[model samples]
Target chain A: MVNANITNKMRNLRDAYSSALIELGSKNEDVVVLDADLSLSTKTKRFGTVFPDRFFDMGIAEANMMGVAAGLAACGKIVFASTFAVFATGRSYDAIRQSIAYPELNVKIVATHAGISVGGDGASHQMLEDIALMRALPNMTVIAPADATEMEDVVPAIAEHSGPCYVRIGRADAPIIFETHGEFKIGRGLVLRDGSDVAIIATGTMTAEALKAYDLLKKEGIEACIVHMPTIKPIDKKLARKVAGKTGRIITCEEHTIIGGLGDAVSMAIAEKPVPMRRIGVNDVFGESGEARQLMEKYGLTAENMAKVAKEMIKKY
Target chain B: MHDKALIKDLKRKALEIRKWVIESVYRAGSGHPGGSLSIADVMACLYFHEMRHNPKDPKWPDRDRLVLSKGHAAPALYAALALAGYFPVEELKNLRKIGHFLQGHPCMKKVPGVDMSTGSLGHGLSVAVGMALAGKLDGKDYRVFVILGDGEVQEGQIWEAANSASHYKLDNIIAILDRNGLQIDGPTEEIMHVEPIAWRWQAFGWDVIEIDGHDIEEILDTFHEIKMNEKPTIIIANTIKGKGVSFMEGTLSFHGKPPSEEQYKKAMSELEQEERELNG
Candidate 1:
């Protein structure tokens, strides 16, 4: 029932991020890390331990930290600046847009604790609009990796790529769907399962839920196609067109707010070839203090909700 | 301080930059002339006299970087970049045109020799600190120079940057405050009161250097005497708003407004008169 015991097998994505950072540090001599006082939570302090001098804790100054990241990148250093998603995107979006994105500097904004998955700290600490805010910028590449294995590939891919990119990472212990690693490329979506009835496109931790929902839809005499889109900007439009041609009906799933995010991007991509589509995400509302799993259930972010929504999309179409 | 010939040459260059600021803003019909004219000498000193930058190799690694935090003063930077052969001086005429590289603010992607794109206030210093920090980490000898506005320092991020510069002991950075004493709304003191300015910087763990920003010799000497105390230094360059123009000086109207046709003629004549005096 929706992978209830998957939590026992799941590993923290932050741990994978830490290991990838260490590997990136060894490969690129100019790789540097900067954090705004949440190094422990974001887990960038692991990089600090290995490369003590290269890691800078900017002391709870997210805006200044972003500016400093831009400057360092201007000086020919590949900079990865990390903080909570709320502070990284919401508190310092202007700095990110002007200093980092405007110049198209080589700064990777890898923010953890995104979405309502940031439990107990409540709505004040969670971020639900980062993907929307970052994707709106002209030169920003937005990515939300699904799990620890996906983060391992994405961390190096963004670092080796020379441009501004915003990466959304999660805080909760979610299930690991992919046992085998796939080649990570920007703007390419992987079709994990093939079906003719409907398509369920998802990103971030929601991809796992989409997988669970796909199985449920299959058992209930409905065939579903699951597409995992990691990169939001430079979205896989060709894939959307191909999927729309295949299934003819679609349901988009994301942990972000429905407005101006993956849903809008998908809609814009398939505008030339219209198809019946339903966006599944947090409606216009804020989150509250609760357990991460409970919040996911309360926000209608479970496999049961997605399966119900998938059935509705099929019937409506 | 004794190099009169060099000072005269710099004064002449500063006068030329002032003329460019007036002409470009007047041509654009909508640009900041007050702050642009206020820090012309400092821009002149940096681009022509002090900075070890290569105009041909705009991305030279060892080049000393300058971040104009008071980015409304973009005309001064554009003029200096043009005068230094980074681009043709004729491009200066198209200050904010549709297809020109020179935008409303400094855009590093479009404009060469602009180290970082900056328009919003209080962000440049943090970038400068990062440049300095990267230099220190890499053992590079290049320095970072940032010019901030007296009014712009009221942004909270300025102090956050200040805390970082001091926390990391970024010695190869110098922050210059173009203290023109006036802002768009009113005098900075009457508006927000950034008084005891030198003391405030000192409290932030900076070695403060107060100077008459217009005097070329004083500016040159202050740069020469930046002691190596392993701390970031702030040079308060006391300047007059719209320095070279007679009618626009100390006038709040010229902060963001261009001179009108009649006012432009009068300002050009005033600048020409100053240029004649400098040549003598």
Candidate 2:
């Protein structure tokens, strides 16, 4: 169970993403934004309002929007395309794989409303396997920023990085966990707290909870180091190795399925290091209609759950 | 348009491209020779006559782009690109082979002259729309041409792309439908029935124009008269499934099959005769 006061610190990531895009648009004249008629929801309408000529509304056709983004990328434009994660990933995967990833085009697909935090939109809207699908592609840089401030940094990072990227964001508000001027790098992890008892490697919104869990674990005399992995594709293997060596025990966390996402990426890297690890995530199941806070409780995604899961894994090891 | 000598040369080139299509598919032991043979004449017109491109400078930003949406018919485009000096004509034999650039489907990254990578059905037109939109935004004079298989239009995404192209008023892009009326299963009409296909594009606000695809002069003249300053155009080219070789044309067998040794010999002989006739 959560303290209910965490919501006070939470801010909408979509609005942060919107401001980032406008900033990127001002700096780079070739930066273009596209939306599949969800600009209002996805917050790309900010960029559309500021740079009308550079912003294209694809009118709810996500697949076409993807191809158009690739085309703009092909023509040397840094394209930021947005929609819900479900439609951006599941609906137009072929376009992303073949047109964008295959060509290694400079298209930044910044999709919001990822994971069950999309809430009452139900099973169809909740995208749990997008990270797996996108990470499997050869050239796609898959990312899920922890909060609004992380998203602000991640947006320009992908724009500056010349290649196809899938930046997943949640609909629900999340606590800011990074500084405004913080230096963010792709394929690297940020250590929120240092400890030797265990490593809590988390991504997306789950990173915020993992930080809270770290505080709880510290109070219980279990020193768990928290590493916030923003970029999932180029999973920080060096960081994984360092953490595994230091702590020798690890628990991966995500707001996604345990299979082939942050869990799989971390496990595949830490496998060589051979640490005793247990992944805490949605145990390969679809989420149902519920409020974002209620879904987190029902799905065992709260800080209390993370601290509990960490204690059990420590006992087992 | 009245230069009979130029038309004669283009006809000979089409036949040559057709011969290479059969040779490459037969060598690879598997390819879609039916669809490849169908688009030879039109592809020849685009590559050698109508479009502005420089093979020596394939990455020229202003070069016209051609996306073969019906990418299973890659053997045809491969031959056309080779003939245009994009690559070696000898490399045609290595199509679909391990470590070969000439893949089973068109890959723009691997192939020299390919503007967009395409293989999945119904994606070419969208890419073409993207390229056309890019050209418009950048104020470039380059035109984007896309070829879609008759059956490929059955995909919902094609309609999605169609709606956007007209919505954006992409006057610099043109789509050609290889309306051969045949697919892997059987005739397109019997398979899924996408009839009134011309009117469908018209309904999408495209300038629909129907023409005989195999007529070189007609194809050339059609490109010369395109209204690229007004709206995106869709040329519904009525063509045979396999246009060149006698036994292959209009037959469903070659839709996805490479010729046997005997069939390959016969196909080559027929193409050789056509080449001689055009050379005269």
The 0-to-1 C-alpha lDDT of every candidate, in the order given, reads: 0.90, 0.89
**RMSD of model 2 against the true structure:** 2.4
Clash count, predicted structure 1? 0
Which model scores highest in lDDT?
A: 1
Q: lDDT per residue, candidate 1, B1-280, as tens digits?
A: 5477888888888888888998888898899999999999999888888889999999999999999998999999999999999999888899988888899899998999998889999899999988999899889888899999999989999999998999999989999999999988899989998989999888988889999999888898899888767899999999999998989888898999999999999988998988887686
Which stretches of model 2 miss by more than 4 angstroms?
A1-8
Each prediction's total of clashing residue pairs, residues at least 3 apart in sequence or on different chains, is 0, 0
TM-score per candidate, in order?
A: 0.98, 0.97
Worst 10 residues of 1 chain A by lDDT: A1-10
TM-score of chain A of each: 0.97, 0.96
On residues B120-162, what C-alpha lDDT tens digit does candidate 2 reach at each position?
Answer: 8878788888888888878999999999999999999899999
Candidate 2 chain A weakest ten by summed lDDT: A1-10
Give the fraction of true interface contacts kept by model 1.
0.88
Locate the minimum summed-lDDT window of 10 residues in model 1 chain B: B1-10
List chain B TM-scores, each candidate.
0.98, 0.98
Best by TM-score: 1
List candidate 1 stretches off by more than 4 Å.
A1-8
